[model samples]
Target: MIGFVEQLLRFASHIPTFHLNVQLLVDFAATCEAQLDRWGILEDVDIAIHYISEIVTNTSNGDHDKLQLALSSLYRERAIYFGALDDLKSATEHGPKPQALNDTKHTSWPSKAIHAGRTYLAHGILLKDTVKAQGYLNKATDLFEKVIAIGSGNIALLVYVCESLAWMCELGHDAGAEPRLRRHLGSYLLTDILDQQNNPRVSTGKHIGRIGFCYLCLFKKGSNQKDLENSIKYYNIVMNSKAIDKRHPCRCALLIGLGHAYLYKKQDKWAAHCFKTATLLEFAIPALRMDACFSWAKVPNIDLVEVYSNALKIAPQLAGLEYALSHRVDNAKLLKNLVQEATKAAIAGNDISLALMWAEQGRGIIVAQMLQLRIMFTHPGIPIIQHKEPELADSLRRATTSLHQLDALMGTMDVKSTRKLHRDGVRWNHLVRKIRASEKAQLGDFLCLSIEKILQLGRKRIIVIINAHGDGWDALMIRKGDNRPQHISLPTSNERFSSLRKDLFNAGLRERRSGDGASGTTGSDNTSKVKGRAVKKIGAQPPPPPTPDSILKIILVQLWNEVVHPILQELGISVSTILP
Candidate 1:
């Protein structure tokens, strides 16, 4: 009977299309019914009936798209069924259930609520219907409250419910939801999960990092110094521990969170160090790097705008007025122009949704501009003085001030507080610090620099010489007035050399031949007897002495070897030098 059920599931799993296979589902239901009858297990019969009913309801409509959705719904149902079945089988065969499961009280209300809420949320998103989505989210919230009322103290279940509520609140900021989210989170104390002597989860630093994250989030909400301290403490524990797992998401999040917290406290140096550590953690685990956009917005750019705008309210910069007017052509000015264009587009469209989307995109562009300014100001290696292009700097400062003012005015609707602004500021500072400390140190710096320089100096200009050989024979040349280096060819008896010479000439390099019919003179005939005798005694033929052409080649080769090679090496170009 077990083998028959496994075969049925295996067949169901292999359906090529997501559309519900009604015939296959019916077969499965029949098989389950037969098995239930044979075993006469009342619980199994009840479960099978529930599954069949849900599956039938889902597939009743039978449009291909609806069928596909139904199939997806069934997938989750099957997962829950499999889990339940495994539990039942284990109870029958083994001595007892795991202690954690044994301790967890079964609450059907919460389980039913979670399942229905998930279905509604999925349908809301799939249909892109905001009203329906909110309805489902409300249902989910109600279910979560019922679970809390049951008072089972199931940490996993509570965490999952709280996270879901937090996500729903974030989807569209519902002011009423904040208190509830906080109340749910407050239930878990430090001692609830942590072991007495050491953190049981931190067998290898990953769990310690996760524990730190939980603390960091708590610190953000409650302003608890102990939570922040414990976060950093656990971070240090992970960093110092030799058993660090490179793939751990917890480690990456903890490092990033630590960096943001330190930045919030105005400890710029410490914040930068934390950010640098976070960046390294991201490299070790690339999935974490996507959080950069969110992290960068927290500190120097967004918060700086808030701080400067508040300051500007009392003390308007007369100097900034003159500067902004003079540099009306810069990026800040350009961004303002784009925003105006976007606003015009919105007004013309006459659709509120389109207008809101355009306005949001425009805001993003403005934020990007702010990020660029913050990057210029705070990046460690780029000496701040170098950014002293008076007009451009003035424009950036004005723009920053202007954006802050805009944010404040907008704050009547979306008012961000000083604390939130400060938190964001610290986060940005940390990110800058982490980027600087990356393993590919110079590579990171170069990448951050203006795109033009990256395209120009960093790109390699290869000069391959055909048939050139010897310790000093020059195979490549870059003329004083030329934009790129040129290749040169030396005389050779082989057909490969003949083809190579043609290739070099085609590639814009000078080609000259030696011997009677060639353009250049033969130097073998000019070898001195004394030098030839010395070469002969050493059992080696003397190399042909330099002619005017050869001397030019030698000088050009020497110039490249001494000058270009070092520059290329410093730029991290891993190309081999062409030798003659």
Candidate 2:
């Protein structure tokens, strides 16, 4: 059957009728990729892809929308393989960009603009060029809107519409139409289950999750309560879904999103509950758990110290061990809040050990807090996996090496790369299943440094930490042989501290005066991962324009009166002890 299909491709160009014949060729190529070792030769995918390109090159306009959409999907399907290959390099270090489907034609069935739009969006995501990505997004936005205006019955199209909108918002662009359809997604989706006779598609949790995200984006920009409600509704749908298991990693993020939404609604109890739940889900990835734990601390009137402490205890994975020092720094920066909040919780509870641990972590002095710990161990290193499954690791390494070498020479619709990508993808999938079956390492106590390690690093030095998180500033004094760090509640407000930090950065004070103990004195710890991280703060406000001298004088006076002088007076260190 495969051999006969190959015979047709050789003389396909001569055939006057194109659509059905060409689809057979494309379908065959897809089959070969799906089951390469079954019947078809490896070169068949290459030939099919090549032939499709020639046919599409001539079928540029008018009526080939269906064909174009099919080609686009094929392009996207192959792109996923590239993304996977790129991701495999993440076992220990970040990998370089993988090969993309660069040869996909701009063809989409004219009637199915949404399909074409989707293809463009997929291709755009693979491209590094900002302008091109935006262009593709814009085209997708237009196509989605046109179909939506006609009120198409293909409910699946509705999900992509919301996805495109959310993606556009992420890119700092908006078509001003997200709320139109997604806001009332309940009206469209009567039942959470995808009845095969109806849409016949599953993964409703994720589909609705996208709709929820669209609403989330809308609420962020406009502060519309309705949008917030819609987002919360959709997120809740996913959370309560029967088809989506509780252990699904995607639910972990949904829970966090739910936590944030509830927080915004002034429903502190629900918000805290959601965050606590997300933090405790052991099956979830460690990075997300860390984020959930961090969010859990921000909810006022909630004593999540136990939860936070538990999250810190589970460092079984290698999230923070990224490619470079800068990567580590970024990772640490991500969880700078985890450090700040941990310190605050410690100070409130008078837990000296937690205070010292967070103090060091927030200073970004010790290795980056698992900040860049986004699940995938990035950076393409040559070391084989050192786990018990050496043979499996060796297989993974070989697959990665093969993909890495071939990625450099491949182009769009390149069959060779596609076949290799498929093979590796299968290997990776199998490896994942095998590892899951073989993996037995459980969560353990990890984040806290031993007393000996801290003492060695400090060398009897007094570690003074000024933490400015939540409502006010806190100063912790870590001395040798003390059961706990002495916590001092400072007079400086959290808002004042953030503004001051911002001002110092603007005026180059932070850069010029490095290693000052005041670096951790930030309401945010300067994170940009979550939008409105500052605005969400109880008394947060924009920083006043650069007033270097005034800011310096205020900070110095506060330090002297509230921090320095008090410490000196208590320790009996007078002017004589400070003589240099």
Candidate 3:
């Protein structure tokens, strides 16, 4: 009889007709009453009556159509179970019934409430109505509380309640329903959920990644360094686990998270390495293709462009010269492609800021190439005023103007002050200043000084550290050498003065390794040692490279010759040697 009741309930749950199920349940209730009468089991008969009454009351009052369906199904299943149990009770009333049959009386109002509440919650999610969904969740929680009050040690019920709350918090964040969701996280025994003993559900690497990410989000909301550290700790655990296959979704998020953490902490090189590594891994995974399309569409390929640009900017000697000579044409083409990709993404995302940033970064690259070209072709000793080619001067003027406009647009874009993002902004700002200083020379000297001052003072005001590409050398001390001043600081040192300076040397090396360019690696330790010896060797040697005046002339001449000339050629503008 017990086995028959169990089978009947299982079958009723899968049935299609709510009304038929209810009718079947009503007939089964009648059968139970008859068996109880024959056996004289009054207590068993009374319990079955209450269960039937509760189901009927809830079903009749249910607000939604789906609730009506669920109530009818439950009514049918309840009828079958109660009828069979009543039969067994009648047969055993003369003696003792089985424990299962005896326990049937305990499943009463609370069980019905829980089932109904859960049904409502599921329907709400299906309807995509958050407010209605939360209302149903409240109902479910109330039912769960009732069960607990009645001392029901149903682990499944407890787990279900906890899982519901956790999801509520996550969804609430996505819906912009709350500013912080961590407060609700404590409601769930997440640790216990992950525990194999308490949870029969399988744990996946993605689950671990979610736990880590939740913690990371909490840390981001506050300045709790410990929470941030713990976030990284959990990420490491998941990444190191055997469950974390390269093909897993968790791998890409974990990599991106680690990169972000490093970047936020002002670890640019490490952050770049992580970002690059994650990009490679993400590209390999077919599932992440959409994510890649979205992310790459937002930002320009500045990281790659900067890697090469900074290489030439810093060390005009050695392979830097050769790299600039060979890659300028190809690099310009790549930058154009990146701009197109970014434009497409911007249009797709409807993000005006991202579109502008990408556009400016692309323009910056073109300007940078022009600057490089001017250095290559312009007569070594001539000033702009003395240059015989009027076309060259005009091209230089036009490129400088374009660069200024690009700078202004980039500067006005809304960039988050994350370490990487801010650093990128700062690098662009510095490039702008450099361009302005190069174009107007003495005329822009005051503005250049003001920019430097702003940067120096801006340090204290910066609230977030962002990963800004390029050598990020605005704060580095300039050492005079040859025609251009040499950068005298190492990148990534914790020293207050040198911290923001990223190694153009290592950036070039990685760019080459990633097949972007030829290697222009500068061993920092070796360079430092060599510099120390050189300074000692020439304690009071000839005065350092010419004052800022000579440097300015050289920069202006280079900008006019390289950037402006090519742009004019592309635009079909005739060039002539004449003073503006």
Candidate 4:
């Protein structure tokens, strides 16, 4: 799965960013690291390391800055793991090399600064030496400030630096070199950027709300009257901003910030009012809600069990919920409830893959693995070696279990445990290699065919992949034997598509409501005949006027006419004679 996902990511790197989900890829990478570390397969760890490095090396012709960021992130993760495992030599070796930033032509200065800061931050966290840690932290802070100063026009870089700095401060690694209020200079700078942008009402409000969070951080750090005053000022700006939408998540965050500020000012009534208003908001940001819950918990008298419970029911992955529950409530039943809610939330969020990954991490590894096996075996177009060689599946499962057990035992790494892990890992690798060889023979290919290979299968044929990008859709097409995929631009832009999607959703809601109304009137004898005719009429309603599928077909036809047909004509396909 890791190898397959890596291939997809590498392929995506060659395409436009609209077609890729970078955060999803990062989450997958994190999952891979977590699973590999949990299983303690030292051999496969090297394979993963090599695979990620290969991505970095192969992506030089692509987006250099994004590629460098990804490479730095991977190195940072590896270094953190190695340091935690007490492998100082490997940790140092895995740390981002300053030489990587020397290529000014290929690498942007912002990218270099961000990567260097991240590297130093990772090292500072992992290193046990306080003096070295402080030095690294200072260096990181300096690099971040440099990027913030130089990359003012680069919103993305500025955001990354500011967020990283905020997180570093939260981790208490800032070394207290700067004054408490001045420590968050990056945050204030971000506020300036937000202030300059002529953004929409809701967007500007959200930006300002986030800036208010920076002041909240200062208040947390100092707890002085001046800090409290500054925090209140920002919170008031957010709350009074006419640009804020009532339903915006930023409104919730601002209220939460105000709650904290009020709490600091020892105004329990105002604090409670802020917390209550925040919780009542139509669209609550999960992180902010968690903070609100934590704040309410700190109050001398208040009941938040219902709030936390219901909030978790909505989004169980909300940060700080677990900690508050563990320390404040500490009930096993509640924890179990949280786990169940999280599992359901993951599935509901259209991320079944993440749910399965979490299941393996938690209590149901075997169950999740079995379910995955069933999916793989039953899924069309997917090759499964388990059907042809059942013994191979059994062997693989056993090897995996053994690997996990060994990993658990070797968590506290030492020379003896390390050697044992390596030995077992080698044995595991031999089994996997043999299985892969056999599967290759049976399946003819170990993974999905590339676009180039797929295009080679037939003449005068095109393989079109429709991808959803935010509110829009993009079609990538490859004609037979084509060297590159052609992008087919649709006539309908993202904003238009978004409006159409909303219309479809509203129509669906109306249909459901009408169905419910009919259900309640089913037994009325006078209306039975009317209901029968109504049902017949509805059944014959010409396939429900322009559903989302039909809308997409319209766009597809537009694409075919506007983009693909021209290319086909250029390729001497005789489009005049070709039939739809």
RMSD in Å for all candidates: 29.5, 15.1, 30.1, 26.5
lDDT of 4 by residue, 1-580 (tens): 6667667755765674524344444455566555433332334344444445545444433343354455445545544432332333333344445665454444456566666776666666555356677666667767766665654335444443444454445456674532532545445556575545444355445555555555566667656577577667666766766656444545766787788788878898788788767755434443455556556656666544444433432232221111222222333343344444343444445444333333322333213222323343343423365666667766756655665666567557775555445545444444443544463435422322233334464356755544333334434445676645454434445566567667767766766766666643343433344345432223233455555565656556655665566556644578664224
Q: Give the number of the best model, judged by TM-score.
A: 2
**Candidates' lDDT values, in order?**
0.42, 0.56, 0.40, 0.51
Q: Is candidate 2 or candidate 3 better by lDDT?
A: 2
- lDDT per residue (tens digit) for residues 192-294 in model 2: 4422222212255667677777778778777889989988877876776664455455567778888988888999989888887886654455566777877
Worst 10 residues of 1 by lDDT: 313-322
Task: Rank the models by lDDT, top first.
Answer: 2, 4, 1, 3
State the number of backbone clashes in model 4: 0
List the candidates' TM-scores in order.
Answer: 0.32, 0.49, 0.28, 0.37
lDDT of 3 at 410: 55
Off by over 4 Å in 3: 1-189, 192-202, 282-302, 306-580
Q: Each candidate: how many clashes?
A: 8, 15, 19, 0
lDDT of 1 by residue, 288-362 (tens): 332332353355634332222122111111111212223223434444433333334333344323333333333
- Evaluated at residue 20, the lDDT of candidate 4 is 39
